[model samples]
Target: MGWFGDDSDEAEAYKQVMQRPQELSRWSNQLLGDAAAYEAGKAYEDHVAANGHPDEHHQAKEILAGVIGDFVDREVEVQGLDFIDRDWAKRHAQRRAEIELYDQHGDRW
Candidate 1:
């Protein structure tokens, strides 16, 4: 078994992490519609362009905190794994941010 438990549990955890972006995107799209979503996405890109890409961990936490709320302690529990910590949050956020950036600018830059 892996650290989390059986392989199935690990897979479930991976699935949960992987689905975060879609969840966020759906939420944003429903709440703001396409035009606003595009604007929101551009904002993230602008932040990266102006301030440079955030440290992966910080970026994840920032996204999570923005989407949800401030993280208590250093971690937040999620599916499969014992908890979703800042590092995991960061990795997820980084992927989400990249997709958002791509959606906004495509291959233009």
Candidate 2:
């Protein structure tokens, strides 16, 4: 029994959710961090500093927006979402990995 359905039922609904590759909020944060790091280069920093303190934040915002936009634009590249069932995806992934390991190397020898 699980979110998708009981043990007797297939987890098709759950699998659909798992197959999607949409980036989460954390991905945006990571993109922002990376953008900020790159924009922190001396030349960029100097240019912003010349403008004013507020301009620095503005520049960082623009850079982060662009980075996030790029990532969103490429969201379609995510695949394998509908292969199984979303609710069961995590358990399926774990079980598959375990089975793979067992197949590669017997559990007791």
In terms of lDDT, the best-performing candidate is 1
Q: Report the lDDT tens digits of candidate 1 across residue range 55-103.
A: 6645633643453222211113332223334444444444444455444
**Candidate 2 TM-score, C-alpha based:** 0.24
**Best candidate according to TM-score:** 1
lDDT of 2 at 53: 30
Lowest-scoring 10 consecutive residues by lDDT in candidate 2? 1-10
* Candidate 2 lDDT by residue in tens digits, 32-69: 22222232222233543586433343444443344334
- Give the count of colliding residue pairs in each prediction: 1, 8
State in Å the error of residue 56, model 1. 18
Q: In lDDT terms, how accurate is model 1?
A: 0.37
Q: Report residue 23 deviation for candidate 2 (angstroms).
A: 14
Weakest lDDT window of 10 consecutive positions for candidate 1: 28-37
